[model samples]
Target: MYTPGWQIVFLDDPPRLKPAARLPRRPFQYQRWEKNIFSRGKTHTPVRRTVNICPMHTLSTISSRKSTQPFVHALAWFVYASVIYSANYLANPAIKLGDTVLFLVPYILTFYVSLHLLQVFSRLGTIWTIGGVALFMVASTTAGHAYLFVILPKFGVYVFNPAHPEQFAKDALLGFLLYFSYALLYFFADRNIRRRIAVTDLRHQGLKRELENAKLRELALRTKQENMLQEQAFLRAEINPNFLHNTLNILHAQAQRYSEELATNIGKLSKMMRYSIQTTEEQPGRVTVTRELENLQLLLDIHGLHCKDPKLVLMYIDGKPDGLMVPPLSMITMVENAMKYGDLTDPENPVLISLIMRTNELHFRCRNKVMRRTEIASSTQRGLANLKRRLDISFKDRYTLCNRKDGHFYNVEMIIYN
Candidate 1:
């Protein structure tokens, strides 16, 4: 029930109590055993369950095609061969067992050779098909009995009767003719199967692309929800009144010395308020660079009035701003720190604020005499800490803040993208 960062403590030993019967109990070794189980490295892989909408339909299509051409060819060939053999038995009264054996020899040779040749020579697809047909015709012809004459005497069929050789040859030729038809049917059926397979492959590719796009959209939505939760936490923490108190004290000092300047500063402060209050709710925030500097100048004016030296320098190098937007309150935090901790009351010491916009980025640099570490520890860097958190939540890796102290001076630098 406890992790490395948590602790369990008991004030005093408790009284003895009877153990329950229904609940299971384990020895102290169970705790160590549980730790090992939970401490194992993750090996979870995402499983995607997909429903194939057209598989049943595709299967039925393949079955339909197979039944029509190839199945019919097989059935027709068997039936045709049986009918011919039966008719010859009934009509050829003089035909013997030797005559029938001789008749089947040519048909068997032609069917086996045609099937083998078609498989070996793909470029001769048309020729093979035509040759199969020609073999069928020769087998169908009664004249093919002449081919059997060469082997008939050896078999003793031709010597038995003069018509023996011719009649046996016709029967063999008929068998070859039927087998050729079966081969043609097989070739066309194979082409159709290939086409079906290509269509299935294309459909699978489209489904994969769709699944990938759906996953990307889900990830984007989850990221958006995480950002919203972070923004809500920031707004809840922003309700403390410390920052507003500092602004009021500075404004009070400015009101006594520069009435006209005080009014201008207050106006700019009001405009800044409109942006800052809303940004606690909605960020990524937006403020034009010109507006950001105007707000910075207001704080600087108040600081100038309150300090004993009553002088601070504001300068902009390179170009001025033109409608470029930046994150709200990014520059004012540094300027306030410069006024609070910098040695501004010393006649020789002054604070400098520089605003530069280059390459679609805003640069804020503040320099002052370094305040001691003990002084910073006492007062705490609340404003700088709050600003850093806001920047991290809104801009993430797009912003940077650094504070450096050399021997005599303190420097704060910030870079934020437009």
Candidate 2:
């Protein structure tokens, strides 16, 4: 009637904390830089702080890096382009402002279209931007003075003389060349600026992901620590009940027969109790396999005096690396339970328990021979249940417990990772 360790394993699996516990409550800080600038005996201390407020825009922060700076860059470019075009046109009356506007209109249109295309088609942004510039060049060259000539006269401006065929062909080619060259410079500068922004965004995302993973590992460790404290408190309560039952059983035996062996068993039981409860000398979770075996031996000695002869076999395999550690009293409890319930006096029905530790993993095997198919009653579930909670806090998913039945033998096994 050995209680499977797996039954207790699930009992103490710590419930997950609330969503609030997982969420970060502290305010996120922005990285800042300080600059000291002086002008005419006046000192200006500028603290440049970059905060990612808008989550969506934060991803595109590369593109918006200049957002905090002057917002009139586009307007400034337009003014500069207009002034240059106007100056060239006014230098010679033959080159009218109307003619200049017509020649430069395609270039201006191409720059805006390229920038807008980059903003929309972020993946193919650069390709579309180049394509827009190419389209502008081709369109303006194909239409030539045919389109601009009609539009200029309708607006009451004259720059071209269709009657002089030589002037029309020569001026039109010069205008196209000038506009195409300007378009190349503007598009190249704008694309370079946007490309720098996109690269910055990718770096930010990589950094953010690394930070989140670190936080998750820290939180998982903290939650494990809290669970261990709670489980230790619970296990400490069960010690009182176990001591009371053993003492009562000993007293009943003493009353029945005043024997020297019974007194010796009582003394051993007292020593085991003192060792189990002495917290000052024994650091929490500091019990070695040797100490745990001592506790199990004491339990078996007490059981031999009270119950009938209990089957016990102690084995230590060689080649096991030393300095191995285990949770306090973890293995002893399962072995103690098998001695208490199994019919060990019968040579045919014996309880077999083995402990093995190798390469940071602790394995426990407890088997008891069962005779009949009758239900076994056990009121308290604290022993193995406490073991499970302690294991979870200590090892978490790094371990497993299972119950296997082979013929008439019932086996409970626990595998723990250190």
Candidate 3:
């Protein structure tokens, strides 16, 4: 069966009664409620209430719009070159072709040459930078000298003059001045473009991380659901809930005609069995701490009906459970172990179960007096083994379990860090 993608509510379905909280029909719902259930003498909830961690948006589509600065930079330089050529062309209409070669060609060449020189300077320091600028100046001046004096004159754009040696100085100075202005503009433009690219990369990384976490959670849920379904099928085949209910109802009706105490205990037993069945089938790794403790009290009450000692067990709560949850049946398994092999006849040293909840942690300790060799058989502790396995899958290493045998008692303590 396909489990709901959001969350299972409370892990409670008490046989014939309505569930404590209803499960939503749709998959991947945005808001998920924590394991919040139960009310005994007071109300308190201490868990993370709202789980809004659902992957809602598409992560593959990185939100990196191409920066418009590049296009703007190209246009600005184009206008700069055009304006110089236009003014020169208008002032001397007959020499239109010469003005294009004189102003536009050197200016465009200077812009690109300065950009390359700046990259070399930034990366390799002053030594290599000096060589790079010298190389650029020589190459650009030689090309400019040839275009203006030899090439342009061949096309009837300008006349060559051997006497005007001052013309070479003017062309070189003009080229250096163009380079200086473009370098300043390139510095700011390059910085801004790099900042935009860095921001886009950071955003893409964050989205990628979130998508990965979402996928891992989904896979865990699928694997856990499959395991639960297999166990539920096995359980259903071995024992039918409807048949148990009918048989319990019949026994209860007959016991009520003879004795009220027997009938009352029978009803409680039926309820406990129903709760146990539902928990195995429905737990979403965890069940409400409050609800599990309440059922624990019910189990104790049932045991009380037959046990001779009035002080069979003691449960102490240092802080309110709030809405905290633990792996289903973890607490119950500890109690079951104590009831089966612990000495409960003595009123002073009874089974002691204590729970302490703090700001960011929870502590649980179960201690009981061990029965003598004559009173109890050898124990295999299969229940505690299964509890550890369940906890490994649910809480991983976030919780700690320790069990030790004292001189005459057994002690088990667990700590869950929030």
Candidate 4:
């Protein structure tokens, strides 16, 4: 694609191709050599692989609990009344239906009234609870008096003598006894239930604390492991290279006093070494594109200085690399690979390299003529694989790298997003 500020500056006169000859295709890419294999006589299209990432979350589920006390109370009341009625039947075998109904009505009222009064005053403190007991006694006595004075008359059974007023006091005494007994039973049962709930809450708190402690310990271990790995990597990257860099600087200075050419080459090598040692701090696995191009040119100059073919490799860079940060050795590895395996003896088909740095991204392409005996380019895939790994460490999925090879030439392309 043609873009403003993009140019192709060849180190030699660029070769002209036939009108029908187009560049070879690239393949799916990310952190590896994505091959785009083609059959000798058939055509194929390349497919880029994509990775989909999603976030993860943890959801806490709460189970619902229903109270069974209401059902239990109903069952207990039924059983108590049945046992009492059965006992009365044994003592008074001639009891009538009206008499049974009269006994049950008063019993049910006293039981429920005591239960409800306790429930209402349970949380109101001891003073209110004592008052509620007194109030319950009065209520039960009043209910008993109404049943004795008015309800029994309807049944024509168990008549209370109006002349003997002591019977009223005795009836109230009986009401107090029955009400207190029922209140005590409900009070004890409620206190036991509350104690169980408190114990369960404490257990849950302990388990929660233990889970939090385990998570903290795991985090600490992971942090320590990461620190160790970072230390090892730092040592490997900085130790030997730093020593060589210093030694080369000294040699360049000394060579300047004897041979200008030797000093220039040594200075270039020293700058390349320094850039490699220091580039990562600038942008994390990146150096200024200008620095990379300078080092790359120096490498080509070194190739020409040492080899018979000075124009075997041709590099073309377009657009300003002003603020752009390219990964160190991004293009140099490709040039070296081409030099190692390509048929650079044929001047007509030199190794071609091109780069374009746009507003927010970069594009790079390279091609090399394959040797006559080689069926494919990049036979071992080492240099490209290493380049892929380094870029992935820096850019992750924000970059693309792919390659294509026919019987005679190999082509590679890479795109990096800022």
Candidate 5:
């Protein structure tokens, strides 16, 4: 029968038909071919059978796909063995190639076998693994010496005969020493590398901890600063309302008198209030000395409208008030204190205010006859204390404030350095 897709032919038969022509009979043993052939007479032709094998399924292909670590390790050991054998051959001209190969084969086999055995034994326990490795090293060293001296001579590769006990003992000692030395060197080197890695890791961890601590400290400082600002705002809120209430009562008293002076003092009060509110809103709350002096002049004008003796409330400025800044209302606080507590009616001992500039320093002094009333004295002390706290916060160590009472005069002085 004809196969559907494949062309098959018998080598023993020759036919007169064309190569492309199909045959009706099936041969017992046939070869497959893409093209058919024809012959005119009987002829013998060799039958060729073709088998297709996938390249990926071949042994060489499969092995090539596996990891190369084992092969590389074996190659490295082989190179090491070759080097040692070559060195030995160079030292003694009598050592032959066969003898070198004979020594290397057993030495390499014993070393690798002992190493594998130790690795397996290591899984049992640390103590047992150590003891097993030591035992294996001794046994392998002894066996290597025996194979080199006793067995190799029987094959005529080694010149030393096994009958000589002294030579065998000396060679065995040398082999043991070499093996022990190599084992110790490997152990120490591995341990040293591990220790260095551990120390580096510890230092890295310490640095990370220090960085975290620094971030925590920074966060804490920011939180404390926020709290301080909020408290200052609360204190300012309390002080302003009480001050405005008292000033409005005074304005009401002046309005009842129906005087033109009340209207002018009202304008001065509005300007002072606007300056105070704007200055409070500013961060660090500072104004130029010129602006501060203008506000002070307005405040004194309003107070002068009500003073029993306006001439006794005196102020003196001894320097050019340009390009100099101070904490807002700092100088005015001292003036306000003097007017509230001093005997300004006394012509001989008037409320004296002075602002002087010396080089990079600004000196402010206020002196007045101290009121004998306990209530006014207590309020004056409280106001001065508040001013001192504000000065400490603003200028820190760059400014100085002094308060003294000499007999009848209460003196307040402050100096700020630029």
Candidate 6:
């Protein structure tokens, strides 16, 4: 049998294989074989078996190791106390080293027990812990002093004078102050360390929240962008059907009279369609000013061929179109609106379209005499509104569009800053 990566072999009888090392034998334990059996002239492929250990069992084993830590700390404290007092004994020849060691025994025991008690009480509250620690320091200090002065004299290690009450009082006060000061210092230092750790933890949590918020904002922006692109694509898909309808109508009209002109117009329409589709798919939906102007001229030519008096529809271009780009079909949209609703029959007040470029700015102006006495109820206004929206989305505040009616002439003007 073939295994994924490794193989294991088991023997029924305990026979010493040439290159196999024996593992410690247990009732259910199996030996892990790492080397391939082919190297040892084995004919059959071996199957590997995996023994799964429970996570709870591993966790219990790790927890068992923590029980010895308190004993280790106690041993370390005992060693530290022994070294310090032994040095003191060596310095003073009057006190025997054994007596000094015996002297430290009660003090160490009282100190550790008080420390443990304080640790337990600290979880209750600050006030209670402080009171407990103060009381412990006082009791331990008094007990240690009594042992040193009263009990040590009995052992003939040191002498004490009960006659001088002032000296005894002074020594007791000094011992109390020393023990109290040490305890308070340790307590304050530990509190300071814990406070610093708490502050660091709060700071880390605040940074983590800020990072999460930043990621959420980025995700929202990406989703918004995706939605906008999807809407643009939907709008683009809608345009082709309407555009083909108008182009087909124009082609049908031209085919009745000039078949040669119909072929040329069809090619122009095809180019325009390709450009429109390509520009809509682009991120900014932009094209060069030269390309926009060429398409606009094509639109004018188509409109002029259909109109009775072609001279009434006029277009003028001023300055070079170098280093200039614009949203596709933007300029042509205004011209189309003018041509659709303008009084083109009147040669005196004809539809006028002008594109002027000055430095880094491009200005476009369209003026057309309204043919109808009342407002023209057509899709012209809706198309203009859609164009305005596209301008706002693409150019932001970099362009301006204005439309006003002066007497009989409806004028639309736009300026785009490159």
Which of the two, 2 or 5, has more TM-score? 5
Residue pairs with clashing backbones, model 1: 136-177, 139-173
RMSD of each: 23.2, 18.3, 21.7, 26.4, 25.4, 17.7
User: Which sections of candidate 2 miss by over 4 Å?
Assistant: 1-54, 57-262, 279-281, 306-325, 354-364, 374-402, 414-418
Per-residue lDDT over 159-213 for candidate 6, one digit per residue giving the tens place of the 0 to 100 score? 3466775775676556455544554565556445444443444456559889999
- Per-candidate TM-score against the hidden true structure: 0.39, 0.42, 0.43, 0.65, 0.45, 0.45
* Clash total of candidate 3: 2
- Residue 317 of model 4 has an lDDT of 79
Query: lDDT score of model 3?
Result: 0.68
Q: Residues 113-221, candidate 5: write the lDDT tens digits.
A: 6455544453345677678767876787677677777787678776455679678667656655564455445444533443344344445655988999999999999
Worst 10 residues of 2 by lDDT: 5-14
Name the lDDT of candidate 4.
0.69
Candidate 2's error at 339, in angstroms? 2.2
Q: Write the per-residue lDDT of candidate 1 for residues 345-381, one digit (tens) a residue.
A: 5556667777778776878888887655525433326
Once fitted onto the true fold, the runs of candidate 1 whose alpha carbons sit more than 4 angstroms away are: 1-272, 275-290, 304-306, 311-330, 337-349, 355-365, 369-418
Q: What is the lDDT of candidate 5?
A: 0.68
lDDT (Cα, 0-100) at 244 in candidate 1? 67
lDDT of 2 by residue, 316-362 (tens): 43336366666676676677766666656566556777777787777
TM-score of 4: 0.65
Best by TM-score: 4
lDDT of predicted model 1: 0.60
| Winner by lDDT between candidate 3 and candidate 2 | 3
Indicate whether candidate 3 or candidate 5 has the larger TM-score.
Answer: 5
Q: Candidate 5: how many backbone clashes? A: 0
